[model samples]
Target chain A: MRNMIVASTSTLYGGGYLEYLTPFLSKRLKAASIKELLFIPFARPGGISHDDYTSKVRAVFQTMHVNVKGIHEFEDPIKAIQDAQGIFTGGGNTFQLIKMLHDLQLVEPLRKVIYQGVFYLGTSAGSNICGLNIRTTNDMPVVQPSSFKATGALAYNINPHYQDPIEGDQHMGETREQRINEFHIYNHIPVIGLREGSFIDVQGTTEILKGTLKARLFQAGKAPMEIEPETDFATLNLNH
Target chain B: MRNMIVASTSTLYGGGYLEYLTPFLSKRLKAASIKELLFIPFARPGGISHDDYTSKVRAVFQTMHVNVKGIHEFEDPIKAIQDAQGIFTGGGNTFQLIKMLHDLQLVEPLRKVIYQGVFYLGTSAGSNICGLNIRTTNDMPVVQPSSFKATGALAYNINPHYQDPIEGDQHMGETREQRINEFHIYNHIPVIGLREGSFIDVQGTTEILKGTLKARLFQAGKAPMEIEPETDFATLNLNH
Candidate 1:
């Protein structure tokens, strides 16, 4: 299997949430001699249409000399992925993404594509689907999903947009750390707090952290730790 | 005209992000002689049906020997609110509530009800509608509304479920205070951080502070200050 890349942000040209990957993504696809890339924009932000947002992503792929297509354009996205060379799912609201995934029954196809060695990449909500469930997501549960299930693309849950706590505030609401901890209380799955610039590059079954910042890992009844990018995170042997 | 009562929590029953308010709500409603209460449970946490959540609020009113009707029960909620004696919007999610209010054209009706002597009581998302916009709300923007407009019942915004800042956490996301500050940057509305067990009781044109604890008030380009519930907040000068 050639493997997949699950990123916390897009490898876009401008200052995107995942601007760090702009060069890396282009270099990898070119070196791999990849001709076409599939894009999934199901995690539509605020329940808005996918066309406008995906167009921006398509433009990014065009710059890389790679053919790009938004999966929503296909009547049978499952079959489209089955016959695709590579895939990329952009980020947005996790709730909306999961909702559309469930509604369209694309979660299973996505899982298949990753396992079939189709070279997949997911950013933000795309990265979130790499987990067993979307419960660890930082996105608010604005709309209830048909299911909290995801593609199980990774062994651990992901808390994207991971942020450091602020000082001298007494608002008493749950912090992002607290929110992730709540997820741990219910699921024993290890959580990877992927900072804005972080991503996990997967080759076959081996998951490699690819970024400068350290990703925080958390499991049930355990303290969180920071591990540098390029670390063999999949070897942690901390499966739930 | 009768004033408004914005609460921090809903049922005083089982729910996440809960705040206690039975003693506070009852005292103010009785003092205002608010007998008929219109219940709006449109936020519907967990995607529970609106009818089921509305019934629970109705049960609360029944226990208090007050006549209650769910706004959903009305053929035209806008007209119903116009003729209703009082209004009580229960909390769930702010985004959903604001979207529904905008979709049904009930925002103006709600504003008129509060202005035309109908006592208004909102808890959580319910309380959020009292502001000029839902910008300072804690709920996730699951769905986008036609506009960010709200009832403008209060001169300032309310950040309920306010928590103190967590110490020694490395999560680098924007804190609730920071998010509210961002809202102020784009707009000039002030925000009031009302913690659990805290509330605001307005009668006539005067908005008096209630509850046992002090609420934090923040204005654009100004440091936040703790104001006791008993302190006449008339300096805000919203009432005319």
Candidate 2:
């Protein structure tokens, strides 16, 4: 059994950091009895320091009386994950995050604890790492990771911060849908385009879509479909 | 001596494929006395076959009375580049293009021919490979190449299809400028943000900006500057 929140964004447009997620997370924290969490700040949004990223998250959790600690602060990171009751991976560059995770040889350790039923929260780049691989990410490859393989905590991949094509948009760059379509050529794994302000609330095997916005579901050799907010992803049978 | 057109895109918005570039290229072909050329259609847009992509390019070049041969048609791809007096690399997916060029071990041969005074034209993903590396490309990493390295025919990297931030964009995804800022933190290489319709025309050592719009020049630890249409990129001193 797994309990997790795979969020599309850490901060909504014009919203304070973790402001939109606090109420929902507070309810989850109480339900799971999770008073503290180990934060993975390797992504470092805007190239911010690990300490700064952790402090930002800590400040938000403080409002809920839940403690947050950076994984870097620990002498033994693998032990930190093993002993933690909860975890949250913040947003930033996925390549940077994956490089560090592989460099420290923490992929297996992190995946092991997640399966052991640790309450987990992943936002943006954080949500990306919980996929089968990070090939669907929208971020620029600023650094090269050892491989594109990621923790298979989820059956499929997540395309976080997914935006629809703007009407009359003249930009020649590939649209989000087009990029994902190109990805389908190389990979058959189902990809969920998680729009900002929405998330997948995983309780046991049922992955329910949360928030009012409609999420896009893209699969190989199939037309992209609009999925309703209350839909349970488990019903889709993504596994081949 | 080097002669090349590193174009931002193969197809201009609301225009036919290679239509906007035809006149510019027709004159160059005549001046260089190049009646025939080799085409590199490896970056198949929308996953088209290499032969199909070459057909599209061949039809366009046929309008100029310039015979076109795809590198795939030749038994020895390296010899094709060596014998060709002119070359044109069509645009599509940068990662796919880089992987094929590297897979065939043709990076060095292609770069050598460019400097050997071949009249060359590159658009979109084609233009991206002329840079120091592929890190600044806007294309999706659908397929992982062996490395992020590119031909390095040009000293600086190219950010093709560069778009300006839409006023009041509600989406929270990183802007083009913001993404480049993150790239600056990890790399000091100067990046030229080539907007649609803009290209750098390299004649010998002087890479002069062409087209009407101004290009965005990004240097690590410095402000992004707007370069005029006639400005010579060789004056930037990018080698450092």
Candidate 3:
């Protein structure tokens, strides 16, 4: 079975990094019998180095009795993913992550291992790759990737850290909703706007919403609506 | 003379399209003795069609006694830029605009004409092209251009619709400043954050801030600071 926890963010405001996710992680990691994970730190939030980011993630997973290893630690990244008991892609700039993935020629190999039922955890930019493409990401294009194509881990796309337009807001920049509407003009993939603390719990062909908050769903030629917690996203007809 | 008005936005809040720019347009269009201008509506704001978007801009330019013709109306787009007495690129999605520019093989041609002393008016996405690239745009990657490369009419980049972090805001999405800072991690190009109504008035090599507001300037490894209105941007030492 495909077991995954694609979260919107690694940290919640006013909470320690991955603190809010402890309960879920403990249960999921134990269920999968995964005591170690291969971490992809290529996203490099705030330009953090791979070793430093790996250490940071190590500190958190250590609290859960899980060992974490950065992919950069291995001489061959493809081999690292193949040998890992589980995989976790952390949050950061999506462009940077995808660029490094493509540069290392790791996209196909990583996708292959994930489908073989290796446990996977993705937060923020990590969650974005679980979708069809990174086109819907809220992050800036600080770096250009080989393509916007992301891992087809899920049938639809993900817009993490999704925000609603503020009432009486005057900023003329297109709001997240308007941007998604424009995406529909050229694409048909449904997009899930996962608010902070929200995530999709994926197992095999089933994907369910978690973290209590209602998630917003946007598909081409249709009005956006809220998907309550525990709703199966597959029922949204997110198929291409 | 590289006469140009690279504006932050096409319309100010609570104002009609291009209404707030009439005073500047009246003087500039008259000074150039230009009665007709070529419009590139490829940006296609709100997914607006070239014909409809052209009509909207034409109505505004008519009020200034200048006729507006969309590049789409021409069988030969490169020739349109070469033959035009002046040029105006309306505001819209920067990715959409630049993608179309590259797709039509118009970047170098437009750049050549602009440097050849053709008066140019660029609002929002239009203004962004005058910069080095579209890395700093606030628009989503609703579309991916062949490349992020822009016309380099200016030494730096432009972050149109620049916004500051709201006090007491709890959203964890990176602020405008933070995003630019991350950009500096991989890029050294200085970026000008043009607030609504702010613009750069370029004459030959002289680029001065206009629209009665202080613009924010971000440079690699330097603290962001405000540039007062009437200040020339060249003094910012924006060399790559």
| DockQ of every predicted complex | 0.09, 0.76, 0.77
lDDT of 1 by residue, A113-204 (tens): 78877788788778888888887766644345667788887777777777666575444444566656655544678888887778888887
Q: What TM-score does model 2 score on chain A?
A: 0.98
Q: How close is candidate 3 to the true structure, as a TM-score?
A: 0.98
lDDT at A4, model 3: 89
Better of 1 and 3 by DockQ: 3
Superior candidate under DockQ, 2 versus 3: 3
Cα misplacement distance, residue A182 of candidate 1 (Å): 1.2
lDDT of 2 by residue, A108-209 (tens): 888888888899999999999999888888888888788878888999999999989988988777899999988888789999999999999998898999
Which has the better TM-score: candidate 1, or candidate 3?
A: 3
The list of candidate 2 runs beyond 4 A from truth reads none
Question: What ranges in model 3 sit over 4 Å off?
Answer: none
**Per-residue lDDT of candidate 3, residues B91-131 (tens digit):** 88888999999999999999999898999999999988998
Backbone clash total for model 3 is: 0
Model 3: lDDT equals 0.90
Docking class of 1: incorrect
Kindly report the docking quality category of candidate 2: medium
Which should have the higher TM-score, number 1 or number 2? 2
A1-240 in candidate 3: lDDT tens per residue? 678899999988899999999998889999888899999999999989999999999999999899999999999999998888999999989999999998998888878887889999999999999988888998889888888888888888999999998889887888889888888887888999999999899998889999989999998888899999999997766636
